[model samples]
Target: MRVRTDSHGGHGWERETGGPPGRAPSAARAWARAAHPVPVLVVTGLTVCLAVSMGHSPGSAALVALAVFAGQLSVGWLNDLVDAARDARAGRLAKPVAQGRLAPASVAGMVLGSALLATGLTALCGRRAALAHLLALVSAWVYDLGVKATAWSVLPYLVSFGLLPGVVTFALPGSPAPPPWLVVSGALLGCAAHFVNTLPDLADDARVGVRGLPHRLGAAGSRVAAALALLGSALALAGAARLGGALGLLALAAAALTTVAGLLWLGSGRGGVRLAFPTVLLVAALEMGLLLTAGLPSGAAG
Candidate 1:
């Protein structure tokens, strides 16, 4: 049996020399890949955790998770659909749409469906939560539409991520506002994520005429910015925890060590630049863990 490989570098589909052809399974895989599943799952998981921590009922927490998952799906799909032409032009065949393994129209349809589902689910959480999430979604859409190529690229991430905690807190009974520290920490971490996420793609982005804040900062500067943002986020969380009487010294220590190690690794000239983003992610996870343990506002507790 002979297999037909996508010359654009996408997953190869199975073709028989004289038998039945296979395209469905590979196409499905491509669709899934195009969804940007990793970040979608991560964001959804974090929302669920925050909902549970904020004293939401099990049903409400589940609703928040489903809503966030749908919203993330919409955002991811729209990103791919909007970037299809650019990706194709840049020879980014790893993108299923760019490689012709998936149709842009189909992806656009999914984007609409998921966005509607997300809106409906968020409305069920309550008007406040719904409004906050709607704004967040709009911010993400703005980034996909055009802000991603400009100096203000980080604005959307700051707006969207800072609203995330409020999306959970407001869904709870009485609709209490999210704590200031939580919002600040989330915004800083989101900024760090933006810088780190853009690092490896800086060259590709430049080739495609995309020059966000990170592009302007250059790689080394972006790395430093990401590290500082991560450290700032950690400090904010730690300060909140300290006010709550938990000290948070351990988490702060860990974040500091992780930041130092990451910077040192990159500076060692051992091709460790790839580890920079992962380091920021690790600090984010650590901050989340601290938030779960000692950073939850008393008013937010069930």
Candidate 2:
């Protein structure tokens, strides 16, 4: 069989089978990879910590963590499911969904189950919190459903992330809505995430017709904008004494280096160096976790 051309126009023999020749992924591995386990685990840890910091009991924190994990799982799978066709066209065999290593039926089943569990857990928080969370999930779904190709792509991120602080706080036994600062700051970071998250895929994304905000910005522009937004968020949190000095400095330095690395990679089109994008985004997510924890008003927790 002739190997398809991958994104780089290389003969995609290594990618043609979703693994090296004669080494197809097992069902479990396929599901795991398709769901993007790393980010889900990181977010789960952060959610647990943020829940505890907000004065929730340990049990509540764990429940919150589980809920968030399931939701993230659902979203991750949904993203792959929605993008499978495009990814296949781009010869992105690293993705289990597009490479057919995982059956779409299995992923669809996982999505339904995970989404239901997420909804049930959110409902446990409160009616209002559940409502907000559903809207947030809906926004994510909207992004996956083709809005990501349009100028309106960032809107979903804005809506979902802006509502996150409210979702967290309102889940408190009797807490009121989150303050506007938290919402606005979160929206900014979320917007930044849209930029940074798309950088590694910019070339392929454009080829596959995904012209989101980052695509419009191009790689270098996206990197710089992402860094600025991340740094701005750090500054916003720090100015209010929300971010402690150590985390703030760490975040700032990481964001700066991440942008620089991306710019270099964009200029050179190197392979190994492209790994910087996801690594830096992981660091930025930690910063986001700190911000989430900081925005919570302690008095509100029951």
TM-score winner among the candidates?
A: 1
What are the per-model C-alpha RMSD values against the true structure? 4.5, 5.9
Give the distance in Å from residue 176's predicted Cα in candidate 1 to where it truly belongs: 0.6
Top lDDT prediction, candidate number: 1
lDDT tens digits, residue span 1-302, model 1: 11123655533322211223465666667877888887798788789778766767789889999999999999988998888777777777678766666656677899999999999999998999999999999999999999999999999999998999989998887888988888888888888889878887788889988898989988878878777877788787777634443545576657666775576455334355666666776777766666566545437532
> How does residue 290 of candidate 2 score in lDDT?
63
Error of 1 at 254 (Å): 2.0
lDDT for model 2 comes to: 0.70
Residue pair clashes in candidate 1: none
State the displacement of the C-alpha of residue 234, model 2, in Å, after optimal TM-score superposition: 0.8
- Which consecutive 10 residues in model 2 have the weakest lDDT in total? 10-19
Count of clashes, each model: 0, 0
lDDT of 2 at 57: 76
